[model samples]
Target: MAPPAGPGATAAPDAAMRALSSFRRRRLAMRGAAPPAWLISLATVTIALVAWIAATQAGLVKPLFLPRPGSVIGAFSNALDGRIDGAPLLDHVLASLMRVVAAFVLAALVGIPVGLATGLNPTLRAALDPFIEFYRPLPPLAYLPLVIIWFGIGETSKILLIFLACFAPVALAARAGVSAASVDQVNAARALGASRVQVVRHVVLPAALPDILVGLRIGMGVGWTTLVAAEMVAASTGIGQMVLNASNFLRTDIVVMGILLIGALAGAFEFGMRRLERRLTPWKGKV
Candidate 1:
């Protein structure tokens, strides 16, 4: 190459080159040796709390908008002492859980079988797909009025609303699971002298289970989301009701606490469902 650059150019380039190399090595080290998932999760929570504390201390965010963590904790303590709303916090949580479990069971009882039938029979799929597709995208709020009008402001209406919220996801998941089943497995079962029902019961159901569990997880999530809307009816005892009742009085601390409680419960449900899936479908993704 040419002779060495002037002293100024030479110095600048040498420093820049060293800096770039160090940057790249640091990046590679970090990227190649990622922390475990739990560590990452913990880091995320820590970062959020640190940010929250900073914002609260700096007064950048209004208490009305985002209550302080200490305020939320105090609200939680109050809830524990049975002063959150008209009833104890556990009563509200229990009421919401009862509604969720009842609605989920209803959806599973109906939607899973219907979904299985739709995938098993081309005719049924053709007949039901349109109806399922139409309602699947509709939000729970849109149909709550009709549900309330028909069913009155009873617990039945609330349960039905959550049930509908859960139904389409569960049904569609089961249908997808059945569709994803191996044609080879079905053919082999038939070849081995299994009857149609037996093949469906044994070959198809097992193949579709993992997906069905996934759908159940999704359905349960939707059911929880629908809870607030469902409890909009003339209701008094539910986590959703507590949130709404708190917001009516501008109790941001209570609102934030309720939101966190709901989020924690949802995460727990998701974790439990994942465990159940692993236990039941241990052969997932295997050839």
Candidate 2:
């Protein structure tokens, strides 16, 4: 064994550590100068609004292409009062919301089970993977004609299109997340006298919950993205239909209004899902 170091050596190392700690504190202080996320978001929004107003109000962009904020607001008011088209804004909003919610719920109800089963059984996954992979990458618009021909240009076709868009993401996410449940955990559960069903219900699901929630969020987004295409199916009262009508009439303000409304609604739903994910998976992202 070596003898202990003298005070001089210890003093040098202690000074170096103290200097490193000071450097870290200084770096943290520097980082503290950055604004909070919400504040940055607000600032970004403010800048965008200012830019939009300046571009439109100062005639940098044509009203035909990009209407002024005031024009859009007036269009919004007219929509609210049912002055733009025969139907009121509430009708359009409700129609779109109903279609999206129906499709998303159906996708979750079907896809989640299939996904779980696929994860639990390699044979099932092998059997299903080909079909899922073949169609998942196809754009919704590509099959719109086939769906219309099969289901007719009715609400059924619209919801089915949206459902197809949502189903793949949810199913794939669930399948991927199933691996998060380790073999050790499964074995442990079995050793504890847990039934197969109990092992899955208690162990697999909790571990996979985060991925499932992520899939739901992604599926919701895809459903909304397909909403416009789905609403193209002889729809008369949905927001997508309203936007189509506005475009035909060269009503740029109304088109902008519809786009903004769709974005706001989607954003609201996304925020709600994030909150739900946090609530249900409090153990997520922790050590």
- lDDT digits (tens) for residues 1-287 of candidate 1: 89877889889989999999999999999988998899999999999999999998799999999999999999999997788785888999999999999999999999999999998999999999999899989999999999999999989999999999999999999999897778999999999999999998999999899889999999999999999999988998998999998999999999999999999998999999999999999988775
lDDT of each: 0.93, 0.95
Best by TM-score: 2
Native-structure RMSD, model 2: 1.6
Which residue runs does candidate 1 get wrong by more than 4 Å? 1-32
lDDT of 2 by residue, 1-287 (tens): 99898999889999999999999999999889988999999999999999999999889999999999999999999999899889889999999999999999999999998999999999999999999999999999999999999999889999999999999999999998899999999999999999989988999988889999999999999998999899876888999989988999999999999999999999999999999999999988994
Q: Model 2's lDDT to the true fold?
A: 0.95
Worst 10 residues of 2 by lDDT: 227-236
**Candidate 2: regions farther than 4 A off:** 1-16
